[model samples]
Target: MTQAEANPRTMGQQETNLGLSRALPNGSGTEELVPSRYAVQVGEIEVLVISDGVLPLPTKMLGHNVEPKERAAWLDGMFLPPDAFDWSLNVVLVRSGGQTILVDAGLGLDPDLNLPRAGQVVRRLEAAGIDLASVTDVVLTHMHMDHIGGLLVEGVKDRLRPDLRIHVAAAEIRFWEAPDFTHVNMPPGFPDALRAAAKRFAAAYRSYLRPFDEEHEVAPGVTVRRTGGHTPGHSVVRLASGGDRLTFAGDAVFAVGFDHPDWHNGFEHDPEEAARVRIRLLRELADTGEQLVATHLPFPSVGRVAADGDAFRWVPVFWDY
Candidate 1:
């Protein structure tokens, strides 16, 4: 049955599969309130998963390398909507060594994609009792809107946290600065707007921008590993403390990566490189048994990678309510 058929009141119903209404819900006219923050301890440090919101991506936009039948079968077996992919937006809050660090900024305070479901990072943080001033650092996985969008809050950057420092990949900065860097799949003016936004953000936060390349520690227990493909400087972060280890895969892989590691999304700058990075990262995570914190996985996006023979599977961490 179609989404409209399932929820007769299309206007009031929360069609998570369709665009525009993904953040709001349907039924009773009463909004559903669920906890947007999840906390876990990495040794002595506290790690929180702050939800910006979710985006209902068209299924056709993902897994472009897979055969139509195979992709359909996989979606069917997973009991997912065939028409749209429910993608989650998650950012990490890390408090360690007396410092508060955020993995990615999320959609900031504005929805650059024009999707209402996004741009909830600040709200989620506030709900979690975290103040913007408390965050000392923000590490960008890449320069995408969904990731770096939260670096500034429209006109309230100083009010939010003027002292906050930003950590980004050197290659990512270079890619965005280039004259021809653009997303073929984005809207006509989206790329230009993004570039403009980047310039604006950098101008305001230039003193705080800390660019790095190769593998190195960004914080006391957090290190970023360069994994290009999804973007020129896309990277995955690793948090290690005591004997515990967790890897924030960023956009290196999404939920579909579990079953289709070789499949590439249409938005990737280099589809081949993206697939390669996903496969290599998946294998390492599976072999090492490290917990994964993905940006585009389900909410409370913490999981483990399990090796399914030659393929891989995403096993969401068990949450005890």
Candidate 2:
């Protein structure tokens, strides 16, 4: 069963509903204090961490070739249910040199993907005082639905940010647009929906889309690096300014995968290549003491990779606020 189907109620239903009408000390009540956005700095650049929401992934699917008992035991040890694992949807907004750049568009304005918890990036961005119209550029880490869905606005099907230039890896665009490109072992209609979304994004933003086949700097300190594996042309963003640097490792390492870099996630097209990329990236990040911003590693997802024996660990950056 899908996560949404298993839960029936959308993600965060209880938390949102519980705080909706609760009486507050101010007596006005009706205030829901949920975490939606966070802000961080990389030298002079400003980054706002906006949350699309959360989706529950099946535990078994996260681990490859592992016994059911092993997965259950690991979850139990971590004080979590064995059935579902929480997956966060995070995107970053970079403000530098008067340019407002969004890292990855979230699940857009629609919830048709059955991930009711997601599709809140636009709303959250507004709440955080970010003007979508002022966004100058959008950098897509991959053509995945959740990452690129928000590139287009709902209803009108126009570009979300009217004047923003969309940036993507040329290899990624080619891979997704290929006739033979197909999803393996995914759910029914999932593959078609993903392909359609990619095609739609390419078609809609063709005029402003900039596909980079080689490493290129989008801004003064932001560069896109080819890091394919999860997808044929998956890429990661690197930000360097003054003396600080951070890597936006999109989909490279999840929470569990942080410690178990060898595990093959079911979502990877080439599990071996994905594992290799994760391990090497994690090791480099850890050894060099660079910051990392991952899309799915919990809310306000900024952290550092750490060496843990032969494996690795994730150390979340302290909340600045």
Candidate 1 structure quality by residue, lDDT tens digits, 181-289: 4334543555666677677666777788889987768778888888998888899989998888889889998777887888777567787888899999999999989
User: What would the TM-scores of all predictions be?
Assistant: 0.84, 0.85
Q: lDDT of each structure? A: 0.73, 0.73
lDDT of 2 by residue, 40-61 (tens): 6677666667788886777766
Clashes (N, CA, C under 3 Å) per candidate? 2, 0
Off by over 4 Å in 2: 1-31, 109-111, 155-163, 179-185
Task: Compare the candidates by TM-score and give the number of the best one.
Answer: 2
Q: Which RMSD values do the candidates have, in order?
A: 9.1, 8.3
